[model samples]
Target: MLLLGLAACGGPPAAIIGVDGVSTRAVDVPGTHLLPIYVATSRAASDNPHLLFSGERSDDVSYARLVVSVPPDRPVGEVTRASTLPPDPRRHFVVVAAQVFGSEADFVSSLNRDLMERPAPRRHVLLFVHGFNTDFPSAVTRTAQFAYDSGYPGIPLLFSWPSRGRTIDYVYDMNSALQSRDSLLATADALKESKAVAVDILAHSMGNLLVVESMRQMALLGRFATADRIGSIMLAAPDIDIDLFRKQLAPLPVGDPPIFVMTSANDRALALSRSIAGGVSRAGNTDPEKLAELGVNAVDVTRVTQGDRLQHSTFAQAPEVVQLIGRYLGNDGNLAEDNDDNPIEGVRNVLFEVTLLPARIVGGGRVVVVNE
Candidate 1:
């Protein structure tokens, strides 16, 4: 009868939503906005191939859900497309409760409900963007896990860009990532404009470039009312050229929403990214010399290594990243504070600021203690 969930927005109208007679709705809350999701399938376009996860049901397909128009109960316009129902509706259109996310439109709306209705006003909304060579499923689950690891599983939003699921699809995926830039910007603008939502973006690898480029466009177009709402940007294994990042910073002129860059010298993928992308230095190669010059908060992640590269993608691949992310979520470290401050220079570990313990200056071997 009535499926009440989080939200409704863009794409196509008449979404099948995996179920036979499904509709979308938009829900709002204090810390996040719940966007509507519909589970449907689109005809595979030439450039766009279908994405598959081995563990998922065979019929599930990638679809976008939205609430583009509203007219009370008059069958208003929807944000996404309407495709034929899949064989398995539950698997095709399972509702997720995450940020500006849309596997199901009500996912965000539902998260809002859980936060304000069930719990309290949600404090943080961390948007996780996955990088190169990842399928849609890998991106979603890992992001959810990342939030779980950080102990903020109830916060709203997960942004997984459309990265082709493959290793050799590097250039193609890079270009594909480039294509999605505009949409990400649109989403960012929408979130910023939403009076009820406070947004933070965590973009990894190619997704970092995507979010940056989107922000740059917003900055150039003077979409700062939109830009300013961006709470913080945490880039892990950023896949952009160092020069490109500076240029991007120049245009956007970071002020409110600070930028935090996490790198790892041990990251072979970034080394390869540097080589293949033609001298485009990545955050993975960030050093004390270049970070401040580039106007980024460089957090070295070399010492925080854990999982297999997650398709050569860093950031959420390690458990420590989750802790670091948790610290950032608390909104303690400002990018201005981290500028030129290489916390890792002396020890060479994954460096980020935490409020729990005071700075430990290495005075001597075992004599090191917190600054008194």
Candidate 2:
């Protein structure tokens, strides 16, 4: 119903790289920002040159390096794309450069080379896993937008699974995510073994399921020995069942790369998912206190009103929320405590105030109360 309608709004245009006699080298625009996004995908190659990748699954993981140009003068949280072909770099989010690696060794070598060029503190890596109904171009653009908005100096990487990018293909997308778990783990391992100082993770919606499941596997395999190299693990609007999420976290040791979950009770997409899952509660709509009891930091954004019509993307679409995340990352996986120099200090103050109050159920949704 509502979820289906929201999904029908469509995604970004097909990525035009090395097509229409366009150069596959970096395109420089005076006011625009260029972001390099390293990619590890489990999707098969597409015949269409504009797409480069398709929704079909591949037996082995593929690697690529893409440079995206972010339009200047746009809103903080928006990633605008050109509606027509031969994208305008000055005004639209377009791929300015692309390189497909023929071997895993080549990709690692290139990534490490880039890491060495950055200052020691900026040698970290940020890996983003997109949720259901996402395509290759959309994921690439989203990663660039997040890196640019957050002012993150670290390398940005994308682990894209074979999502059909259709709202009606929920079951297929879920299976695809599960199918790509091994590939995600391999990608993470590559990052951990690279010359980078640390690897931070950000996952949205159903992507949380993939992340958690892969982490559980990592724990079982005793891969947390080098967990010191892992930074924040932020889950935004997870669509997993509450009980399943608990089981997944049970195996992990305490404080292994400190986990943060962003929840919003008003998320209509999760509400619909809950109904589809036989009324099982989705983790994204759970109370913060309940999540805290599970040894994870939970930030509730139900009070924030900025996002798309469905309210599922508030973590990225809300200016205040995105700024808060950017500040958290900039602070090296920890949010500053009462810093006046922080631009989003007012939002942080409000969040702290609400967190102290007890939450109560209101008309089947959770809401915080004030001591009157």
Who wins the TM-score comparison?
Answer: 2
Where's the lowest-lDDT run of ten residues in candidate 2? 345-354
- Model 1 CA deviation exceeding 4 Å by range: 1-115, 118-123, 193-196, 225-228, 309-314, 332-372
TM-score of every candidate? 0.61, 0.88
What are the lDDT figures for the candidates, one per model? 0.47, 0.77
> Residue by residue across 1-372, what tens digits does model 2's lDDT show?
655666667555676654321433225456776778999999999998678789889889999998887776777667777677776666678886789999888899999999999877778788899998888888888888877776666888999999988888899999999999899988876776689887888899999999999999888888764445877678989999999999998888755566778888889999999999999888888877687777777777887777777788876777666766666664556643333443321121123222224544333223332121
lDDT of 1 by residue, 1-372 (tens): 011011111222222212222343222212222223221221122222223222111222333432211112111111122234321222222223212234433443444454464222233456666777655534543554455445442253545455555665677667766676665664554444333345667777887877788778877888755335466677777888887777887775643555667766767777777876677777557663466555555565555446444223445544444555654553434422322322311111333333223222221101111110
Name the best candidate (by lDDT). 2
Show where candidate 2 strays beyond 4 Å: 10-12, 18-28, 226-228, 337-372
Q: Model 1 TM-score?
A: 0.61
- Which 10 consecutive residues of model 1 have the lowest summed lDDT? 363-372
